[model samples]
Target: MDGYQVYRDAMTKDQWQGWWVTWPLSTRVRLGHVYDRKSDGVRRAGDLAARGIPFQREHGTPDGTFIYDSNESVDVAFKASGKTPAALSALTEADAGASVTFTRGRTAFVVFREYSQSGISDVRGLSHALVSAWWNKEWDDSLLAVTSVVAAAGATVLTAAEGGAVAELKVSASAGVGELGMADLALGASVVRHSALGAQWTGTDVTPFYQVIRLRKNWLGKIVAEYGPRPPGRGALPSALPPLLSEEIGDDPEAALEPGDRTEELPFHDPENE
Candidate 1:
């Protein structure tokens, strides 16, 4: 059946308070459930956790709906459904938020968020990129799509319309690859924009900012090359700098990189300066 049909059936199902579907990764889909009460949802999720089932709890909706989602295969979900009092289901639908149409080969999903014309255009472009990445099995490009959306939205957390990819990105970030990749993409995009502005740039030259980004990017590259993707084992990913470094950098590149920073004088000078 088509994605819309699956979505309609899930939404109309009587067993769960609410239901939705998402693509945690291009290759896998997750089924999500909403409950009428937090306690019921928490208890059910806790039971799953105790049984070593993989699931993720999302923030409550505006109406106090508690959410829990899992990426288990259809057979597994059905088998596990009896373990808990709640009925479990496989992710049979494409992301409802995206309203995606899944045909034989191509998939197109919509994002339902209010945005200006420019914002809409940006999201549409990134959505196309995401679709292309999915079709081509380009995991890095898929990751890039997620980061680009975050950059475009200027937020760490994604909107409901963009929630489909959150779980997978979180898993990747936990593994260290996601965060490093995001940093690289953001820095690269900033450098490109800065270069495009050229002398027309106002405020601080931000040449220092470019240097910092490059140093960090190069360091990240080295780390990847050394460790190969992620470290050997699981747990918190290693960081070259302390958490305070992120605080110092803050979110704004302009504010983070002031003039006359020590790194500005480092051997790697800006190409424009050379």
Candidate 2:
């Protein structure tokens, strides 16, 4: 095939890149925004999101996330689902990182891109102790590490996971139970320069519903640590156990009595006296 020949020729060139260039390193890698069935303007990025939005004729994954309208240049909308005054205040205070999902035919989907906050990201090289002690046995290790927190800056508060100023964590777990994992990663670390919501971005007709979640490294570490097992041989005291109710007592009153007890028999003349 001519295309194959062209590929062979391109490979001959030192600068030529191939399929691996576009290959995804991880399944959880951020892709892009997803348009739901109900969403008016945005298109769905089929099968790519794993949610499987069917592709319309001539419309595919890239087309769904990005539409190059000559008239509008491109259509994009930022919707803030928060109705509270504080929500507005937080938006005003700092650019928020958000995960936006629109529904399509009762199924929700988003674009898979490096910047998509909604997408999952794997935390690789997890500590053995962290895995055995903290991680749930049922959960897949590859799916464990994701974008735990994201903070964005902009007028409408476009939340982004990648391609913005980010604090990258370099975490490691210590051996033994109950030992705290160390986070030597820098706080407020800077991310590579990339497109952000602002001059280059505009709005669309579709109203996007999203939530504002705040997470920090310390908070994430706390969560990871909390899930960890307690140190070995550490037993709870009897006092720590919940107290039993009187109804739970045995039928035999003598058996039910504790170390100290006094029993008295009243006269049987209750009705006779009356």
Candidate 3:
């Protein structure tokens, strides 16, 4: 699992592109990155709305702990299930149809159409620098997937596998002491496992991940969720961007359908579907 090997165990070659979203029991963060007690509740949301950016929203519990699923994919189990295309949603290698379903502890909230610039490619190939960081951080069990670097001149694009895996981060010399750069980050946030519905399913938190996913490149540049009204406490997540990137994600201004604010009966990958 250290060196370059077939990604067969991680994803389906037939469907090289696809993602899923799920919400797990809220994470308990000690030294948090995204969520903290000091931030405004509706600030991020309001900004997105004001900017006219499209996003998905859902209702939460009494404490305002509404769960949100960002850009997600399921390339592994789909192939194993031998399922064909139906209403495949989310982003895919072929088209823009989405699958809907629910799981234990959480329900399908909604899925908004993803918006991103074109010309971006998925990153392929492997490097020891990436693996060593993850393994040393005790994160060898997770899937390792790579994506193409978009717009970034000097960086590499690496995304986690469908089930999700933890990987290392690389930093540049110009990176500051506590900068978001790889070396400064050293060991970043934990990479938790996701359920079929995209919930954080891994029993405990895995090693900190080092990938950097830009907001311009992501569904949202910044994420704000109401875990529990009482400052649910911020938790760790994957890095903000991939390793060694050097540019911003361009705005494509492409017109697409809205994914909507709720999920449907997702075709859970099963033997029958296969």
Best candidate per TM-score, number? 3
Q: In model 1, what are the clashing residue pairs, if there are any?
A: 98-110
User: TM-score of every model?
Assistant: 0.15, 0.15, 0.16
**Per-residue lDDT over 27-70 for candidate 2, one digit per residue giving the tens place of the 0 to 100 score:** 11123222122222112232222422121122111211221111
RMSD of each: 25.8, 29.0, 24.8
Cα lDDT listed for each candidate: 0.20, 0.21, 0.21
> What is the lDDT for 260 in model 3?
16
lDDT, residue 213, model 2? 14
Give stretches of model 3 more than 4 Å off.
Answer: 1-18, 24-114, 117-127, 134-138, 143-274
Query: Comparing 1 and 3 by TM-score, which wins?
Result: 3
Q: How many steric overlaps does candidate 1 have? A: 1
Sliding window of 10 residues with minimal summed lDDT for model 3: 29-38
